[model samples]
Target: MENQQQTWIDLAIAAMDKAYVPYSNFPVGACLVSKSGKVYQGLNIENASFGLTNCAERTAFFKAISEGEQEFQYLVIAGHTPDPISPCGACRQVMVEFCEPTMPVLLVGDEGALKETTVGELLPYSFNGKDL
Candidate 1:
């Protein structure tokens, strides 16, 4: 699983080419590496409404869940920016609901940078099904 996680992160980095972010021009790619060793990739798609746009993290997570992947244990986000790219609040919420507290979220930059953090550390008070 270790090697597969790295492969998924690289795949997420490669998925950035499919980003359709014209407004912010900040293309982002994400990968949800499932516990079953499946890797799902997502590229940010923008909408004119802006509010209707979906983030790469959620897209990938939803895609995996639709495919019967209910146990995603690792996520990696990559962008062209110099700094590591983290998930947005909405994405973080989705992740909190979709994964366990110990799941790792990896942030990577265009220059092949890396920052690995557990979901528990990144989101202190994440919303879950119990929150409602």
Candidate 2:
């Protein structure tokens, strides 16, 4: 992995440490880099209701968007799974809303295993605002 990717993975792991996972105990973290070079970190926050839980990827995107960072450069998601972690459907849709189709996304898993992909690759034929 490249140095910057490693750094993002490390940030995601650090963010994972702060996850609030009282139910499933599956902690996930995300690191998002904006076109302006700002970095945002987020972790999953579970709710007892289950349906109200917020994913780490969405948290990162929301945080950046709330702060007026629209254009994204990269995204990194970290988890303890056997393979690199994949974003949930909701998170993929959110990415399609705010991120460029070619924006890079990096998934980090156990032992620092990494998978490189793009937003469009993660959600093919996605539904976006243009379809509305």
- Candidate of highest TM-score: 2
lDDT of 1 by residue, 79-110 (tens): 88777887788888888888888888899986
Candidate RMSDs in order: 1.4, 1.1
Residue pairs clashing, model 1: none
Clashing pairs in 2: none
* Residue ranges of candidate 1 with Cα displaced over 4 Å: none
lDDT of 2 by residue, 5-108 (tens): 77888999999999999899999999999999899999999998999999999999999999999999999999999899999999999999998899999999
TM-score of each: 0.92, 0.97
Provide the global lDDT of candidate 2 against the true structure: 0.94
